[model samples]
Target: MNFILFFIVACALTFSLFREILKRGSDSILLTVWKFFSYYTTLSNFLVLIWFAALAFLPSSEIGQFAQNANVAAAITFYILTVGIANYLIFGWPKLSVYERISDLSVHAVTPVITFVYWLVFSEKEALQYSLIGYWLIFPISYALYTVVHGKWSRFYPYEFTNVQVLGLKKVALNAIALSISLVIGAASFILLGKTVGRL
Candidate 1:
């Protein structure tokens, strides 16, 4: 299943990237690629791709072992689930070409669901800790910081909430705080769920 998911995610990511590149029609493919990868959805999907690949082919390797850690797995699950939920709440469903629809569903919906299900069913729950929620938060916080700094330079923010130019620093800071609180709640829920399931 891990291998199969790896293949599916790889295809989805590749299709999305190529479609983005073609849509941009930029002479500088590198710039297009960089902009494409700047989105949280893209980064989350890419993380899952690397994770599934590690689980499928390198179970005994260091990275695979790291991926298998219960806290790490839950963190990945939350991040990907955020991708789907945030997309729906913020963007809703826009009409798209068939290829665009496929890519969107794969990354934003299918991957998050399957990844969470995989973690819930297979991940070792014994190691989950409340303290680790702080650690799990590092990725999103760092991404938020990166987005603000990068957006300032590039005049491009992937999400409207994070767009400081239009929203101003105060609004963007408030948005970040809200998101951080939500993530804390979400991570706590995951830890509790893991403990409950582990007891069974």
Candidate 2:
């Protein structure tokens, strides 16, 4: 199961990354690399890599629980990215090829579902805590700040929600606050679910 999860995530990462490089260029890849790292989806996938590695190599009752926390956090980010992208598509973004759609769905949709199920069935749920949600916000907050500062110089924002130029600083701050609140709620819900199911 760990191998399967690893394979799926590896495929998604490779597909999304190579497509970016191909469509964007070899010499100009730095911008694409920077933009890719700026995304929550990319960060979440990196967490999934850690989770997968721990599952494959770590002792079940030892380090695996620690890795489960990473998975829970990653699942939240993946679902958030999925919803955000769905909204983007609803607003009439051009349709993509089937492979592109599959790659997108693999990261944004499938990864979340699989990770959640993996947590539910295999993870030591007692390890998850509501307080960890506070830590989870740090990445998103730092990324938002970087996006705004970088946009001032590069004139590009990776996501519409963080585009300070078009939305203004106040609007961008509000969006960030709203997303932080959502992350708290989502992380809390997962923690509660883990506690409840662990008793069963």
Candidate 3:
């Protein structure tokens, strides 16, 4: 993983983890810190994803301060224009207006496209080696399970590599297994990691 990318994602993840700390504090100090964080980080997935893409593929710079700002700005821009708008349109702009009827379905529509764009742009064969269990396998399995159970064919499709297999059960099963384990692991390292991380 790129150091810049890792830094921003870790920052974003920290912000996400501390969201309740920001919301529920009662001190001026907490409020000040919260405001600063929210202002500087902007707390957008788009921004973190920009860093992810930069880390995965972009070359390192002697001075990356401007590039860092540019990534966050790009995230804010995309979030406002595309994903944010889609969210508003699908659910209407009421305060927390997520009725069960529309909430699950809309997430299905939104998450995959966003995830796809992020994965397509940022994910690397090398990076996949490190976080394949988190990034690659769990997502496809959960997505397939959700689509199968909910029976809603959102515009997003999981498992792009074997997505075209319209063959019989044997061929589909073979492809599934192949795709699942084709992370090109060196011996039993992933297995050891999987044992420690617990199943995907």
lDDT of 2 by residue, 26-48 (tens): 54888888777777677677667
Model 3: C-alpha RMSD to truth? Answer: 16.4
Q: Which 10 consecutive residues of model 3 have the lowest summed lDDT?
A: 123-132
lDDT of 1 by residue, 1-200 (tens): 99998998898889888888888864489888998889989999999999999999999999999989888888888899889998998789999999899878988998898888888889889789998899989989999999999999999888899999999999999999999999999889878988999889
Candidate 3: stretches off by over 4 Å? 1-7, 10-140, 147-152, 162-170, 183-187, 190-200
- Quickly count the clashes in candidate 1: 0
Candidates sorted by TM-score, descending order?
1, 2, 3
The total of clashing pairs for model 3 equals 0
Best by TM-score: 1
- For TM-score, candidate 1 versus 3, the one ahead is 1
* Candidate 3 per-residue lDDT over residues 51-168, each given as its tens digit: 4555455546623433344223232223323334444555575554234324423332333244335433443312113433333244334434443333223322222322333444
**C-alpha TM-score for every candidate:** 0.95, 0.80, 0.23
Measured with C-alpha atoms, the lDDT of residue 196 in candidate 1 is: 96
Model 1 segments more than 4 A misplaced: 25-27
Model 2 / residue 179 / CA error / Å: 1.4
In candidate 3 the C-alpha lDDT for residue 124 amounts to: 30
For all candidates, the clash counts are: 0, 0, 0
Q: What TM-score would candidate 1 get against the native?
A: 0.95
